[model samples]
Target: MGLHGEELTFGVEEEFFLVDASGQLVPRGPELVFGTEERGGELQQELIRSQVETATDVCRTAEEVLGHLTRMRADLAASAAERGLRLLPSGTPLLPKSSHEITQKERYREMADRFGAIARSSATCGCHVHVEVADRETAVRVSNHTRAWLPVLLALTANSPFSGGAVTGYRSWRHVLWSRWPSAGPPPMFVSLEHYENSVAAMLRSGAMMDRAMLYWDVRLSDNQPTLEFRICDVAATPEEATLAAVLIRGLVNVALRDVADARTPVIVPDEVLRANLWRAARDGLNGSCLHPESGELVPVWAVLDELMAGLRDALRTTGDLEFAEGMLARLRSTGGGGDRQLAAYRTRNRVTDVVDELCV
Candidate 1:
């Protein structure tokens, strides 16, 4: 916890697609970018050779997150440019080939072997936010409290409206593709930390997951760090948007922590309902209604967002992120989300190339 009794410390991890001069997916981009001996550990290869990931260090404020993400994105863009490639921060590849493009790593190979088709089809990119927690138990509590709101965050970050050079008719086709994983979606509420561990252990024994790291829940306790990870968002189109997401996630976690401290019971929506809400968010982004987590009633997406902001008002202020969050929210509503922006770009020239060009720039 920071000085205000809030765990505002957080970090962001973003995955990007590497494209060629014409904005087509480049199969060897990861090898060219991250294969060198001088490459830093912060940049890594994802499941696909054309995909690269960069993670920011632990950030104490939204400004720090923005700085780290800006530097990392600039470095990655420059590196890709040097290799005659362009780095595109998007959820799905605009022109991926039909075949799988796996990175040549042992773990990645093992994943391809185990998951088969699902692994092969995973050229998707996402943004993950990790917020520090006191311990495993507190992390579990925060995860439970935070699960209901994950869909709202997902809608805000929807950037993958097209896939394989055609409109998917969904704002976040990446979420649809990612939901194919057996371990994906909202996790069940656990009675305790031991219960959570046992549940994961059961999944491992069932051969449903390769390891603890394969637990792809929308929100989960980090396997390698003392933080609760939020995996519900697509990679934003810009560093500023990513930083906005990190700020909102930190605020949400802080609000959850305060609720736990006050002995407030976590909302326990049915798994089916939660999944439906997630689907709604993925399909519509902020253009349609969503299931209100607290009221169990369908409401406009903007209404749900306003409710979320209202709930986190104090926490956002306490963490010194209120003004920035509000400003970003207003801008998002005004200009529309990343998906809308992509659609607008496509609508302008009726060319997917233009969308890719816009995203890459």
Candidate 2:
């Protein structure tokens, strides 16, 4: 049976760091905050005890996403505050200490044991958006179509500019740090669902990754749900930013599915080119040029976004998210994105600690 457009529900998953009152990373705050029964399940500990993750329920509209995200952020912040810690939504800690403790879980323990220092040193956080699809076939197709655009999304949501108590000089240093993994970056094009499955199986057998969960492509088919998860964005610093990112991602999926229904061929940019484009976005964000996914020529970031929005216009209209998406995009363009805002704050105070303080609020 052909897939229907109305099945395009979406959800947002955001990872955040816990900081002390001085705006420094706290290695045990997540455990202290989320280990209690009263804290409930909406928040969970991450690989590192300094980090926590929260997910919103599946939402169909941008308004619902904004509402859920706002409520969850407030709840998580309150929980953290009660423990004398603050919730920080940036992609990386501005003043992280040399080491971070791992959460007390078997899976996290195994990851630390298997990966050694790499696992321990990874204190980065991110925002993931899952867009629902009808089946694995559609998920794979949507993932393929969405690959090129992931970097553009990353540029728009770049929030990590500092690491290890110093400026990293990259807009989304989280992406740079994440690229150290063997399975990160854009996924390769696949001819069919079987091809995608075989590729993941090969990665598993090769021992490069522990399991399917480690298949950390920029976008991928969700192993535990009927959705295509966009894992490229930094955890946005504000609720509105996160909501806008989710809305655009859902619209992108809708447009890709429509293309699939029409039997249009998917754009197949070379993996090398795709990786270069991702690097450019990570290093410079929207302040610089990006390689056009179709033409492979360097273009201003705004132009690329314009083309992308044009492609998704119908999907946005059908989903009733066009107005919200457009307004957010305009604001981002005018005021700059989260990373730019962080830098502006740092410049004003001449201190990374002050930047962290801004993020805490």
What C-alpha lDDT does candidate 2 achieve relative to the native structure? Answer: 0.84
Instruction: List ranges where model 2 is wrong by over 4 Å.
Output: 32-41, 96-99
Count the clashes in each prediction.
0, 0
**Model 1 lDDT tens row, 1-361:** 3424645679999998888877778777567555533333277777888787888888888888888888888887877777788888889877645335888889989999999999988889999999988589988888888889988899999999999888888889999999999888888998899999999999999888999989999999997988889999999998888988898888888877778888899988889999999999999997777899999898989999899999888888887888989999889888999998999999997898899889994
Q: What overall lDDT goes with each candidate model?
A: 0.86, 0.84
Clashing pairs in 2: none
lDDT of 2 by residue, 318-340 (tens): 87888999999999889898888
Q: In model 2, which range of ten residues has the least summed lDDT?
A: 32-41
TM-score of each: 0.96, 0.96
TM-score, candidate number 2 = 0.96
Highest lDDT model number: 1
